[model samples]
Target: MFRAKNLWIIHLLGWVLFMSLPLTIVSREPDANFPMLVLKSGWFWSFFLVYAVLFYGNLLVLTPKLYLKQHYAAYAAVFVGLLILIYVSQPFEKLIFRKFRQEQGREARPEMPRGGFRNGPPPGLPPGEEPRPMPERGRAVDFVSLTLFIVAWAVAMAIRISREWRQSERRAILSEAEKAHAELSFFKAQINPHFLFNTLNNIYALAVSSSAHTAPSILKLSQMMRYITEEATEHYVPLEDELACLENYVELQKLRLNAKTKLDFNVQGQPDGVKIAPLILMTFVENAFKYGVSNHRESVIRIAVEVTGSHIQFFCQNRIIERREDVERTGVGILNTQKRLDLLYSGSYDLDIRNAEEVFTVNLKLSGR
Candidate 1:
């Protein structure tokens, strides 16, 4: 609304400046009569009305409906018609000015001498001499009118085209933002179900054996589920909250591991005031436990996270022991996490993964808020 009001103010100022030129010229005359020469003149009022219609009609109607629509032939036809109207109407100013001069001559004339020649040469003129007629200003007036008409037409087209271009650019930016939002939502939906499925299977194994750890595992699962359903729905969560959730998950996974499996988890630096994308770090740790643990052969899995100011660093490595088929399924979660990082952090994060023969490693760095 403010922008529209400003545009109207600009147009009003421009027309006022254009109308001032004639007033300035008339004021320079020796016996200038503002009311008789300008205010009462039919030509002055007609010029204002006609050009106003031309400028606004072209800007609000013709340019958008015809020129912008690629109807060049129809646009040209209408423009030529307006020019013809201007040409035909040019004679009005000349006729009005002539009538004013005749009235002035009658009012200023002195009483003629008795018996003197009527409508003849003046007293000082030589015999057989007639006065020369004043030079005509009709051509000059026509030229000025034509020039102003062209200027108004050009300015109207320029303004309309510029406005259209800006609106198009705004629409394009809005469309891109909406598409990115939808893609990020899809990735988060995939991560939630994948995490839940793996954790449930571990609890089922403990329940079959009637281990004492089974009851405690169920309590920890409830806490994790509460975090997922409530806090994880947000795009970003406090670093401390995410860390607590991760600790709960690690403890639950430990209940299913044998003494031969060695696992190390570590965190460095204070998490105060730091924020990170929800559930962004869980996929890598889950992959380590799924493929790196063994019941008979010795196995090791390591995970570490460090925070320094707004920067976060994560590293995870594990000895691969699962079958080839299981290792192939690991790509699903990792791929989805990578896409989420691109949409959320884009240039602010980096991730590297290596699947060697004996060990698989993941290193990720994030610039957080």
Candidate 2:
């Protein structure tokens, strides 16, 4: 409920009421004794000077540093110590000035009528004497006020801590979100370079052999380019479009492969109006070609997609070579893809992988929504 500007204004007003007002009010009153009057006025000024430094220095200036922790004990110590110093210094100041006055020729003291709030006398003191007792500063009431003020300050500190905690939590969540987005973009970027390189290799085959399928290969590449530009960036695209792209990719792969390697693909559910990532399945298919199936005799690859109204499942199984030295590999694109899946689907997707029986398999289930 408090702002820095408003709190500062309130502090300034409080200073006027407590310090300036009291000194100004007492100064207008006349005292009964010449020496007593001189002594009292001088004492009030001395107390005010000490009180000013302590109050302003601690509350306004030092509060920023002390705000680190709720150090009520330190605040209390400063307040009580400053007040005690003010109380003791007042009487001694009077004695020193009185001695100075007699040493000079300014000892012609004149008495005046009593007036001020302490016209009778300062409280907690005997009748006119050399050592007068300091008056009550509303002792019991002040004790209660100081207690309440301490509690209020602690409450303010608690509120500040809570606000900072919430802000930090929000920042952490946002940073995680940004990191996931970057990973997704990196994965998407990987898809392009790999696709382009494979297509160029296919084109090289056509140039080397003078095959008639070169024109269709060019057409398929164009379609894939269009998909990447328009639909790939979207979170989801029509399932039919995804399948069509997959079919194009398989045909493109066929251009470079021999008749020994064959691909089996199946679909069980409606691809009419459903949606999915444009290239999520393509990576698995390409991986199957790259690592799963070696360029050898009797190679087989299978891809199946089952799409329901509320969920979708995809499975890929391909044969791997037994004698390959590097059996396991994690490419940049795959790492980026893993991070993307974590952020995009989180708990809504399940992925299982197995390389048993010399056959690599991947099964993934993702929420449709």
Top of the candidates by lDDT: 1
- Candidate 2: RMSD to truth: 11.2
lDDT of each: 0.82, 0.66
How do the residues 97-180 of candidate 1 rate in per-residue lDDT, one tens digit apiece?
Answer: 344445445234444454555678677888876655444334545655667788889999998998898888989988887887
lDDT of 2 by residue, 136-253 (tens): 4442223322332344344444545565677789899999878766777778887877777877787778968889998888898888888888888887788888888888888888
Structural similarity to truth (TM-score) of each candidate: 0.80, 0.61
Error of 1 at 44 (Å): 4.4
* Pairs in steric clash, model 2: none
Off by over 4 Å in 2: 1-138, 234-236, 272-274, 292-295, 322-335
The CA root-mean-square deviation of candidate 1, after full C-alpha superposition on the true structure, stands at 5.0
Q: How does model 2 score by TM-score?
A: 0.61
